[model samples]
Target: MGKLPAADWTRREGLRQLTAALGAENLRWVGGAVRDTLLALPVKDIDGATPLLPDAVMERCRQAGIRIVPTGLEHGTLTAVLPEGPVEITSLRRDVATDGRRATVAFATKWQEDASRRDFTINALYAHPETLEISDYFGGLEDLDARRVRFIGDPHERIREDHLRILRYYRFQSRFGADLDEAAEEACAALAHTLKGLSRERIAMELLNLLGLPDPSATIARMRERGVLQVILPEAQACHVEALKRLIAAESTSGIAPNAIRRLAALLPPAPEVADSVAARLRLSRTQRGQLNCAASRVAQDAQNPRALAYTEGMDGAIDRLLLQGAELSALDGWQVPEFPLRGGTIVGRGVIAGPQVAAIMRAVERCWVAEGFPGPDRIEALLEEQLVQVLRDPSA
Candidate 1:
């Protein structure tokens, strides 16, 4: 990590345009972009640190015929909107103060001061735009090489500055570390109660992002043992960890990608009401809540017939059930569950005296069709005819 990876990311037109706007000597790549570059991972986000003030940044970008937004002018951050994507360039800043949720900051010209204000050492690495020289402020290079995700100064102080960092620490560790930082883990556990002050959205975001990582089975088990998981999700128990691990193994075996909310459901007791309560507490989106409910209430029919399950519970829910149950998912790959071939109008056209009876007949036929392995539309018509005759013969039945 002496220099940034020998990649074309630096040669990107947007970055070149940005470098030309802010003198190459004045701009340095910062944050995750710099960190991931050192690790040779694909850099998706491009952020930079500059000694120039926000007004200067805006004027420079404008004079260069570049589009820049005053995204966080108060914090001296401006986003250079480029063709590749928006790159955030922030004036060197030192935190004025923080109260675990928000921070007040003032601009400064020192890079070390800005790096000191960041959460973790690995994230504070900086890279020169032209020379690709990494400015190691907090031994980030060493930490990066060691696969460590340690807090910058004091882990406790960092967590106190933003209680969300407690979760963030674990999230970063899960993503980047090979082993746990015991002292940092203890700090997070000690101050886990402070997480209550943070917004549910923030908690949900971090928790889900952690759960959605490549495979967070070990990290999750660590969180559970450290008491951090219980602080955030009281519903989770020892068994849920095992369930999540099983789900991970199943996901790998079936070649299905991981879904964060689905993993959250695995942590929860398999009950719809419990899932509902957790979703409500976390202020999850309607789609997320629905998935949680569907997962909690597992379908009795096994994944042996995935189409029927997919038909009733939807593709997302069906895949969730299959993964949780550790069932084969080859049937779901590139398989778009088709709509029920029968329709209410089709039943009504058969002279069955349309009403609730039409819907009833349609559902009965649909169930038979599903039971018979989601046969073709032609088969559904025959099933519909037989059901219509049987219902018409015995209206009470």
Candidate 2:
């Protein structure tokens, strides 16, 4: 792991002084900040651990004139909004009970006490707030350097403590570009069936985070291979796995654009009901829900059309759908759809009544104009007046 930069050292010193004011020992940085500092990845939120209780931390912050928010007071977490960003300061705590969803934890006075409750060994590393010294109670430094994702203790026990950890393991591994530890993978596989007990929202959040990875298709395929995908997203059980692999690999190799919706669309099964159900279960945003609907509809509509590329799916939507189609079929390069030159107002002004007939005339003119390669607005307007005159003269025609 690289040494903490000078600026990080400054922040660490500030936190240490805050801890000193609270009379708390062992106040240190923990979790992602430490892991990312080692990997040289950008660290956004810095999480700290301290023997001080949440109230005590708040008292210290108040003394320092720092803004404090009781973000997770019940969970022993306090947030101090610094100029750069909010720092999350959590009191050392160990889980007393868990139902795979929420945990009951008690504040502890020892750093190891808190470290023991963490999900993975790598996440258990801590850096002293003042000295910028790393303290690894669980061989976290070694596991991190080895690029191995391993649970702190018995995988089953850790998983049972929180089933979400099963999904988190894969998500973290994908993000860090680390290989899965064999024992951890086996343990995850063994408890894969228990994933059904987790809430759909929890599963959805993890999947979204997983998709946000640089190359999530392969990790997703691995999840499918382990049956974890089946348990969480049965709609995708029969997804074209090999096709997805090739699509992602090609995108990486051929410099093709990468997008999630396209990849998801490619993996969608043939069953509409299953697709809709999955979307609903995941509680997708209205826009995402609409995009999925459009992707599915377009895939079916353009199934046999060579000119499918000409169809109007929104640009973002098209990219998503095409990626999902995999590399086997090429997506038609998108082109802007022609706008209608005449409106109902224009048609009514041509002595046509302001009724359904006006709308009908506008539609007819627009369709013909688009079909005729969308000539200039002047030509389209002249053609529309002529067509309207002919239509009014011959009702039957």
Candidate 3:
């Protein structure tokens, strides 16, 4: 057993009232909230499990004048929106059947059964909200202290229940697991093919989170060894691992927050068509697809001045393109990119009639300004004048 958090869990009035309404003994804080609290980590989404079914929980919430949303009701879960925050409550359950994607669960009254059906030991622990007492049926606290991510019961059986657990397993390992548990790793490698059965949306989300983890190089290396990476991202090359490593190092040294799509670009083959194929395969978001395509398209083109690239594209896009080119990270050190000073109106003011010519002259002058390292406003005006003289001299120049 593990000691509960030093901070009193019952201090919040809503939690106190909700506990009384649902019957404190019948409900205990469960899953990530409890796990995070015990580990002294930042807790989000205070979730709990109850012996009472979903409808009963809803009825109790209504009677208590608490706002209730029947979210995940089919899975025996509901949301109780309180002033402090929304707390997700679910009925204790056991898997009735599963199809490697969704599970049909039967509500259970025993805590042990609920704990047994979960994916990993660290996620199965429970804590009494009022008593601040801890419960451990699967030795989750020990695994948490050890930072070992072990699947509950048999790894193969757990993964067979939901193939998405294969990805989830790696995610947890990257964030929490001190080192890959041998049994879990072997099972994931053996069942890597099952990942294809999962939905593209789920695969995309899991991969994004995995890539966002600080220094996921080791986990990704293991994923490649287990053939998991090929199943999800066949377009990726093993040699790109070095590029990913450099990106991670750059991010750490520069204090830049993690960008999953940027890191994904580093792992992928540097080709625009490859990005298109991957974007389609993963069903990436419109914004994500655009970023991937832009980074891939610029891979072959050298960005001599990252500040100029940053001005043209956003800072994140510039960093992604530069990292792909293996450019010096120091180029991003005092990032200051001035906007091009020559707009259509500025060109029209130069006595050039505002029409296709104005637009063309603006484009031509802007190109020259960028090529000249984006000079100050006065210099930009001089360049614009020079382009105007050339255009007037030959109208076709």
User: Would you list the C-alpha lDDT of every candidate in the order shown?
Assistant: 0.87, 0.73, 0.86
| Weakest lDDT window of 10 consecutive positions for candidate 2 | 302-311
- Model 3, CA-based lDDT: 0.86
lDDT of 3 by residue, 236-330 (tens): 67888778888888777667788899889888877888988889888999999999988887744556777668778877788778766767658
lDDT sort, best first: 1, 3, 2
Model 1 agreement with the true structure over 221-302: per-residue lDDT tens digits: 9888878888889999999999999998888887778899989989998889999999998999999999899999985566
Model 1, which residues run further than 4 Å from truth? 330-336, 377-379, 395-397
Question: Where is model 2 more than 4 Å wrong at Cα?
Answer: 1-26, 249-258, 270-272, 300-311, 326-341, 368-375, 382-390, 393-397
Residue pairs clashing in model 1 are: none
Index of the highest-lDDT prediction: 1
Clashes of 2: 3
Clashes of each: 0, 3, 0
- TM per candidate comes to 0.95, 0.87, 0.95
